[model samples]
Target: MTKMTFRKLLAATALTGITATAVVAEEVDYGKFDGYTLRVKLIGGAQYEPLYARIAEWEAMTGATVDVLSRKNHFELDREIKQDIAAGTLDWCVGSNHTSFAPQYGSIYIDLNGVIADATLAEFQSLALENSTVDGRLVQLPRHSDISNLYYIKSLFEDADNQAKFEAEYGYALTPPETWDQVKDQAMFFADAPTFYGTQFVGKDEAITGRFYELLIANGGALFDDDWNPTFNSAAGVEAVNFFKDLYEAQAVPAGSLNYLWDDTGLGFASGTVALNLDWAGWASFFNDPENSKIAGDIGLVRAPKGSAGIRTGWSGSHSFSITETCDNQAAAASFVTFLTSHESQMVEATAGLLPTRAAVWDDAKAQFTADGNNFLVEVFETYAVSMSEDAFTPPLITPWIEVSNEIWPQLQAAILGEKTPQEALDEAADAARIVMEDAGYL
Candidate 1:
């Protein structure tokens, strides 16, 4: 038999630590569970691993062992969980979940409402809690929320020669973009391509699809009608698609952007090869660190730009934990999840630049940053807080979202690469999305 130790388990699972005293001091007593091993599958990445470190503290407190069953990225973990469902091998008690992926799991996860203390549930942002609930059941406890904002190289905008040339060409002073039209004009004005491009985007998979979806919404288009039929092939949709097409045609963004993911876009901006990037709050720390970014101290940010309809693009979601229905120790699993999302644990994550789900953590984290004299993160948290409360919105809570996204993004790529026209690509994607809705019984 393989023996498990806390270090071995954490390294194998790529998990991180949390603030044990803070959570334990506030929660229902975690009674002793000597020798009980709670198994879990978690999403793994550098930004996410720090919170996992606190599991050892939980083990020490409750005398329960945490056996991490698997550690993979969200996309890979989604596939693994689906396979586990089909195979009926959901032996793990807790799994990482997302708002966009939760509906597809149906009743696999236990309803967390009664399991978690009411006060604890009330502590989370109401919108975060609402998004974590599906079919009137709280299936998951949110860890952190996400929304995109613009990041740019401050030096470029401050360059006097570039500023004069930009104002002359676009009839506006050079500054951080305030609208999608300005983004386009500035991207064209700043771009040199190959060596350096004005901007880039997540080009394929759900990344690009999510980008298009939010832009479509901001452009006053809806993805579907009230009955769930696809309606995103409208004039507004055309305008959204045209935005990408124009950027690509002008070569203002990277040539390989269609193949890029979050890491690619994040690293591209850090490399100082891209002047502007639209990304989530998760990358805020990494983007400003001198060790990781070429333009470290020179970075600037603003809320995501507005579309023709005058609304800001604010595609959003949250990372969360769910207890599986098949678990033998539902109570223990619930306790573990609650402990992880507690105020102190959330502060640990928020300190590392992750956006916390708890409302108070926002104030506390901002205060901590301010006290530390970290003005960059201070502005970051403030900007994101406003967006989270007022501007953020999630994709339609449906099981077929990923499948539909998978079908739509490739068509977007073809159009951006000039292999098809914008209208043709959206028409094809709408047809595919129709089939997905039909099979999901929404037709």
Candidate 2:
């Protein structure tokens, strides 16, 4: 990608990342903008809403009102942003961005190197800032990082009958799964259809494409070779696709799973009808609350299972805030994002189980959880921390990522729904993706 002169690769601060130490929160000068109404677009979902509650404090301190124009999921927001870019209608000051999706926007967003104070940027974890950088430009501020870990029903594995039955059928003990094959076997064992399911996944949009990508990596397949030729129709790719297809065909997952997104799978597991769910840490508090979940006290968490190549499935990224180049209130916009990702702001999100981007919050939040006797959240943090460090990785950080994903996911669904064999569907998707890479000058 560096060989080309793409405007999208506006390198942010390409400096070596500095690790923050245990230091006092430096007071920032959030400049007053009285009578100023900052227009913004934000990512909205149950897991992401807690931090928005702090906007009132920023409004009071800065004397500016926040006018949130749109609050939707990432996929919908991506579509809307693309539309805005086409019509030259980026009338807002700030918008939500992700590591995987930020590259698609080109130079629409301002590089934040000098916009945010070096002190403020240094407070964040090195990895989060590194992922937020595009080619060379630091285009966004990291909000919270994300990686999936398996959440399952505790009692199911403890049930004596289940153990005996599973051992008799599969020649293994009934326990937390350690491999993808074990997960398939256990899911099939527990599923009763329409009432109970073995597992569930986000089935459409870039969500499924991401799920497939991680599994493809786990099965020892790369999306492209050194020259960026599409190679996902290889043997390992077929095996990964078959993992989802076989579950769907056997009714081990929800019948409507092909249309389900994150909310569906998260809520399904909490309802106690699903035996397992692979999900992010933000749902930890919600999943364990008796007021919101039927299986509140019966939950067990584990790292995601490994695949045929003995590699764990880990597709990772960060949710972030970005400033628009056209914003009339650039200073105010920078202040807003700084306030949003500040130590205090991140603590609010961390309390709700969202991984903090600011390094200090990790220790402080765990200490708070221990003081509060919230062992579940402590465990949740520990389990997720390892995955974030060891198993985590991002997809190709290229401008054509979402475009390629659009071509791949529909083909993924076709195979999952029996419209085509895995090999046939992947072949068609690979052909389409090759054209995308070629047009983008990666071929």
Candidate 3:
């Protein structure tokens, strides 16, 4: 029989990591549009801003100017879009969109089927293009895939004394975990509270909702039945919720973890204080950079762990660009959208460890990594490739996904904070979500 070590687990079912290397790709022809200004709303952060910097390149090539109306995180941008929908103010030409959030926007964004060339659309991964489509309309052009995997301080698992002690206490070798239960055990074992943590999670908003939803699926639980009755209060659901509750109660994570978003958990891991982090590929470049990460050279990567049902937690989405349906200059908007997702543009993002949506970019990026003697990036690309093909799945493509999430998160906080049992909180959240579904005519 083959020995199943932690290092072996990181590949196959074990999982992925990354770093940056610039590759200049040939530019595509985005028609000239002199004397035109394009307006956009973008998702802004360190990992994402590098791609937006290339907007200047797009402008120079096309002779058009870009006016970025707002540059904020997705959660904030989501609220702005929601308000725009409520107030009838979706006047911008193009905006950032996500597969998980696109259904809620109705038809404010134009269909890209005829807008973008079929030849160009053919270059993107079919699964990516499929996720960007809502109600049979290709509402957005995918930028990159968003899938999380495990990242940890490598030296921690490699320490002989620590490994021996952990093996004695847990009756297993101290290695990268193959399952979520192992994750909990290792986390608590490594934790030394207030000074450091075993692990940390994104604590609130649709962020936490996605985390819970994925864990629920991992535990063989469904959020709703075939008829759409909310079923997140089942035994499997309770088990999933307890995963977070136990971590919080044991102080395995930071005291402020319930309020952490991506930045907090990401920076925590980079600071070398946290033992484990499950995060997106976009941050891989930053995490492995010595200038930015204290544990840069000592990092280990693995696929996200499996739950009791043997399913890995794979809550996935894509960051994308979309043109508004009401734009006065549809041709210009289309040109701009096409330019941003072109081969060269994806190459720029690929350097930042952002997973490319363009199928060719993946091959080219991995080739560049191998040529550069960057085995870390090569391993990351290989591990993440398996995840993208087999494990990745989006939340239910429905108009009320965010609305339902609003009801679920607060109750989840209640459960984690010890105010309610997992069942009680999920049941109440389900009651609220049922009303939302009925109001939306899903029931």
lDDT of 1 by residue, 129-177 (tens): 7778787899889999999999999999999999999888878899999
Give each model a TM-score. 0.93, 0.91, 0.91
Candidate maximizing TM-score: 1
**After aligning candidate 3 to the native by TM-score, how far in Å is the CA of 405 from where it should be?**
0.8
Best by the lDDT measure: 2
* Model 2 lDDT at residue 70: 98
lDDT of prediction 1: 0.87
Question: Candidate 3, TM-score vs. the true structure?
Answer: 0.91
lDDT comparison, 2 vs 3, better candidate: 2
Against the reference, the lDDT scores of all candidates come to: 0.87, 0.89, 0.86
Clashing pairs in 2: 11-136, 11-137, 12-136, 12-137, 12-138
Q: What stretches of model 2 exceed 4 Å from their correct place?
A: 1-22, 32-37
Higher-TM-score candidate of 1 and 3: 1
